[model samples]
Target: MLIKSSKQVSRWRTPKRFPVSRNSGASPASRIEPGVSWPEPEGATRVQRFKVYRHDPESGKNPRIDTYAIDRDKCGPMLLDALIKIKNEIDPTLTFRRSCREGVCGSCAMNIDGTNWLACIRSLDEISEPSTVYPLNNMDVIKDLVGDQTHVLAQYQSITPWLRSKTPAPAGHERLQSPEERKRLDGDYECILCFCCTAGCPSHWWNGDRFLGPAILLQAHRWLVDSRDEATGERLDELEDPFKLYRCHTILNCTRTCPKGLNPGKKIAEIKLMIQQRRS
Candidate 1:
């Protein structure tokens, strides 16, 4: 959920400086330690443990997992609720992105329990063990759970995601599509651009600078299949590069890790087939 107060938003925007620890040189696992233990409220039962990644680049200390004990009885059911509790009551310095707690915003995507997930929608009850939360893998961490998305956002813009048509609208009316034509956009249009699939893909981990990855590729295909769009040839030309579209090896990690359950692997394959068909 978005920070409710302007003051809270200001506090979240400013990264608090943490004192550098003597164990800065120790490995992250070796430095695993418990943080402040909030006292349970009266009648509160069932404490939940969270091993959260903490890092403040301005502090000059290495990243470490700080364990926090949360009173589940006092917290909400979702994992994001625990995080909010931690920030509000336990430690304000702890940082993460969240908005539209309903999971539509896609701002709360992070690495949870060795997989990328939207923390706002994932339930705390779903985690049987002490939950581990970290920034999305293979991206520069902005602070703690926030990953620098400059490259990914740039790649998304590179594809020109919006529809393009040479034909003008008839009599000032909007472009129209048949029901069957609109049905073609079902799976593709559901993508919220969370980048979970991209972060989970081994190919993106290795060649993210060039591959465009599954999330962006899926968006490209979304436009490619839009009946109202008329730039299919130009979109295909932009995605025809070896590293751009051919890097996907059908590993299906993108499909497996997608929080939205859309099949990026299949969309990517369709792009390749279209390229080949055009060449032939």
Candidate 2:
């Protein structure tokens, strides 16, 4: 190929650049300085402030709290709705788990304003001040609002929550229980394994290595009290260790913070009572 001279190369034209509009579809309020209150959008009547914890291990920076201003009138009444609005409209990088926007899934469980709760069920009106949101306490945070629940789930699995009977069920029939016997499972059976109670317990915070936290212990009690189960003795044997069962000091934090409002403290006490009766 023939080489172009300096005059020929200098005459070549470059592509034209267009000026971008300052007021584009993107919201300028999204890039506002941290800790500053975001301005209310046009036609928005109410603005709710939220301070959420943010962390990314790969960023090699210290964790921080991010402030977000949500238009209350445009969003749903629940805290989870505000979170979703932030993730979708304001900051796409915001991360949190949510499903079944109702309370049944327990996926949106987090610490809000110093209490562990399911965000989907918690009304935004309940928070009088600027709400603070965080991941569940005493658990490793995987990212913004997502916590690592591997240990808590492992402890739950150790309890053998399914029915265990020495004798198999009758051919082609499931195990049956009387209505009175079924009533025994009312408080215990409702647990959704959210681990909110476990994360809230001081005993688990201190002795999580060995102690089965309130959630797992409550699940253990569920199996122990099952009318169709025949492994009470074996289950009790597994939970007899001092750290495994007796570490609970009855601070009632578990009971106070359970999002489901089930009494895990009472269930743990019942387990202790059963063990005491067996020994006596």
In order, the Cα lDDT scores of the candidates are 0.82, 0.81
Least accurate stretch of 10 residues (summed lDDT) in model 2?
A: 5-14
True-structure Cα RMSD, model 2: 19.7
> Which residue pairs show backbone clashes in model 2?
none
The reply for model 2, stretches above 4 Å from the true place, is: 1-45
In candidate 1, where is summed lDDT lowest over 10 consecutive residues? 5-14
- Pairs with steric clashes in candidate 1: none
